[model samples]
Target: MDTECMHINATLAKSGYDIRVFGVGHYCFNLIHATAIFCLLLSLSSAVGVIILLCKSRTGKSFMTWHKHERFLLYRCICDISYGFVHTLDHAHILITKDHVGPSGLCALYALLIVNTCLSEGLFSLTSALNAFLSVYFRKNVNFGNKDWKLLLLLGIGPFLIAVLVCSLGVLGPNGFFCAFDSVKGVIANAVMSTGMTSAILVALFTFYVLTWYRIYTETKKLKTQLSNNGCARSATLKSAKAMCLFVVVYIIQWTPLSIYGTWQLISDVPFGLFLAVVIMTNLSGVFSGTICLFNKSNKISVSNKDLGERTGHERKS
Candidate 1:
């Protein structure tokens, strides 16, 4: 193993190009690594908070009290934490070794983890949109109890299986410098995987959001009758819709450029500016998720509390 490492290092030194992890200029490198660390901290903190909430709400009654969209946010937190942790380590390894290429095993593991987390992130976004649509359109008729299990299976297990398959097939592995599924391997695996998954998620999110808001608009007249004059149901529905809308925007901002670039790279080389955009946007995902979710969660808590208090007073008067 030592001999292999030495040979790889010597070969890299012989080559004209330096082995760089971020593979960018000095200024861009500083910005990228700085953002990476910030995102790591942000993601882990939010994920820990969500885990605490999940533990506290383990009981059936308590769990059911949360807005349906919040569950998908839980999934997002998990994915962000996983992504952030692995990403931080990748950067650390590159810095400590001062070599763009990390150890083979770690590189492979990084590739696997990245693929799984990214897929889960996209899946959770889709789930959030679906939940919002159902909440608005089906109202009292929609029950996620049975269907949630299926969605959970798809979100949790499906990505793992795909990652395993890709790794085993040797289609997805470490680049000469870092781990990626991209064309760095002279294969279209990264392009195909990223494009297919992202396109599906983006399309579903758009469709769901349109249908959800449209349903909410059409149900305006019936909201009062169906909500029993308390307006709690109506308010909750709007909150869920708003959360989903924000989530979709975040998803697009963070993932779209990279997805498009990955697809484009399959056919031709990507420009340095576009590549920088992808790097910056992808790393910012955790920052976006953490900031947005924290803000929305606080709002939801206050709204729910107010709604509960109002309902209690009305019941007492009756």
Candidate 2:
């Protein structure tokens, strides 16, 4: 009995001291490693995509006149790609230090995570703000002014400001092995970061979705009204409205599930694997959205026409 007690004590001591064994199973470790690798690959692919997009933009004249919403969406995609790269580094660090190495490196990793979270949330909030602006712009009676600009700026900055405040309160720091705080502090930090960021995203999404739907409804009504008076103009407006609605619907469907999972994880003590899966799935929304937007028929036509015009101009110059 004494020998058994001693062995148990030794096991407990080892468990406490070993960072890798801190309640994480082999499967969880493997998942983390896999996720890191996946994000790294995604980052590389996004980098290539970005390069291609830039080249296309430069060589294509029609690509230059992006509508305001398109510009916002493009910026959002760029931010997501940047965030993915940062996360790739964090995942790599976590995988490398499967066993607790030291607090120093872990702290740096945690800080990086915090920065990435901030940037990503900020960009998403901006996207929402721009969507709202687009809705207003599409209204036939609405006119832009200083008040509108101010309102737009406020909407863009509000969620990001909240995130910064939460970070300042120490809620958006770090978690897991890399967290610098004690158990209680780490829990609080996680709760703060998760709740604050998720709340911001939810608010942004709800606002954008509502505004977008309203715009689509109004535009459809106007198109119906104008169908008899001007068929071609009505058809063009309807087409644009349909495209916008489809884009929003696809965006919501792709993102909503991951957001639900994140909210659930924030409130509950879910398993690590589930959380990892949610993260992976959440990031995929950006990939899907980018792919659809970049390859849309209107976008492709504009790009092609711009390319042709650019080539003609270059030939004339030579």
Candidate 3:
């Protein structure tokens, strides 16, 4: 969506600028972001609360002893906070200042921030799927022997470095309610890099999740054969499967719309309804992740039945 460039004669305007909101009057503009701020705050609060719930669920356990499942949720919490804080601040700034023009370099920085967090979250999710695979097939979370630091570096620092390149085509400018990639360079960059990367991640997610489900099915069958109480075993296992199903459903829904639609947006104007759907879905992911975490600790079952526990984080790689 090519929003009217706030700076008509600015260098960024020549290249084309896109703000966060579009095709709206001042009143509608304020309404959208005012609502955005509220939702982002809700998501932010949920993420923080989930962290507390996680810590509380392990009240008797050692604080330093991070389990596989707990670790994923913790990573998600940090990402949520990073995104929620920055996004909310951007929206709030616009509302307070009633100015669409962002600070000199803030827009590109914000765009970079968006890419980094997204990449990190996708990586973490892939790691979780790998954890599930290992737990179901090999009966363990990944063991790096003594080179655990390598895994840490990949998860912790890799996204930041990668984002520098992924968003390299992006330039700073007012993008509606917030600052982000300018239109000419930004749109093309997003269409290629963002779509390609997102498609790759989605494909990976689909493959791992399918394998995980197959493993669960086989495990359920094994339990039915070994245990006298076959009904109980199947029921327990299905409950675990249900949790994993939640992640699969939400992930596809969350990512699919934008990735597919973004390419079309390169050629024609983005439909307002589609854009709004993307925003609402994108903003609520933090809420979904945090909500899952809060329930996970309480709903977790024994690893003997559920490789993917309610933590769905698969804490029970047990």
Candidate 4:
């Protein structure tokens, strides 16, 4: 796809089409396609696991008793599956054609799906962090309840609408072996939109997590003051704090590279490593986010089930 686009651009330029090459050459899958295949497998398996785990009802609990974090996981898994499907189809086409040029319309379709995937992932990542923030800030009262739809609208619907608009407006087109905006304005617009959105989400996550940690710190200090030697309680609080820190840390490490890649496109003459970083990081995002959410969700469900069992046992004893 990229090889064809480069030829088209070169031909257009010779014919005075005023196309400035964003960067030289097309996207090479030789080095990264295997990694991408692995990501697809990992994402699909994780998504399946999360879906199965999320559906099980524990005894007599109402549907409303579902955790807000579960909603985030559900959305994340859905997006991962969609994203993985789109990516797999695109790469499969390329591999089958031996990296030959595909139809522009098909390439546009690919671009649209890719944008949707990226935007949805970004929004949901933000939503996940926001969920954690609410969990910390509201403690036992963090239920969105009636406002859950509003949250869904902002995180899911909004991003999808924006992606559709971008696609319809032709802000995305064929790039190389994949689809992206080729024109200078299109490239700039895409860079700004992609980088700006992801960076904003990351910033929000950092801000919320920092505030959450501060709250944890204040509560821990208060506990120490009130109880003087609540050693076990303090230890548990510290562990929770560490867990929160780890969540934020993993989110940053997984997401920052893609944001960097988006921003780097605006500059000329970047190193090959930066391009490699972008491809690898962006492709592996499914693996990272899916695995992390699955791991966390499994642990949360296990804990909930254990608590439920203990309560049932106590009731029986009574």
Best by TM-score: 3
* Model 3, residue 244: C-alpha shift (Å): 6.7
- Answer with 1 or 3, whichever has the higher TM-score: 3
By TM-score: ranked, best first: 3, 1, 4, 2
| Clashes by residue pair, model 4 | 2-176, 2-177
Between prediction 1 and prediction 2, which has the larger lDDT?
1
- Which parts of model 2 are misplaced by more than 4 Å? 1-25, 57-64, 100-126, 129-174, 177-183, 214-218, 221-259, 262-268, 271-273, 298-318
- Per-residue accuracy of model 2 over 164-217 as CA lDDT, tens digit each: 554454433234433323223345554444445555655666676677667656
**How well does candidate 4 match the true structure in TM-score terms?**
0.72
Query: Considering only N, C-alpha and C atoms within 3 Å, which residue pairs clash in candidate 1?
Result: none
Q: Is candidate 2 or 3 superior in TM-score?
A: 3
Residue 206 lDDT in candidate 3: 88
- Of 3 and 4, which scores higher on lDDT? 3
Using lDDT as the yardstick, the better of models 2 and 3 is 3
Estimate, for each residue in 116-212, the C-alpha lDDT of model 1 and write its tens digit. Answer: 8888778777766765666566553233346467777877899889888888866554443346562244246765677766877877888887887
Query: Of models 1 and 4, which has the larger TM-score?
Result: 1
CA lDDT, every prediction?
A: 0.63, 0.47, 0.63, 0.57
What is the overall TM-score of model 2 with all chains considered together? 0.62
Assess candidate 4 and give its lDDT: 0.57
Q: What alpha-carbon RMSD in Å does predicted model 3 have with respect to the real structure?
A: 5.2
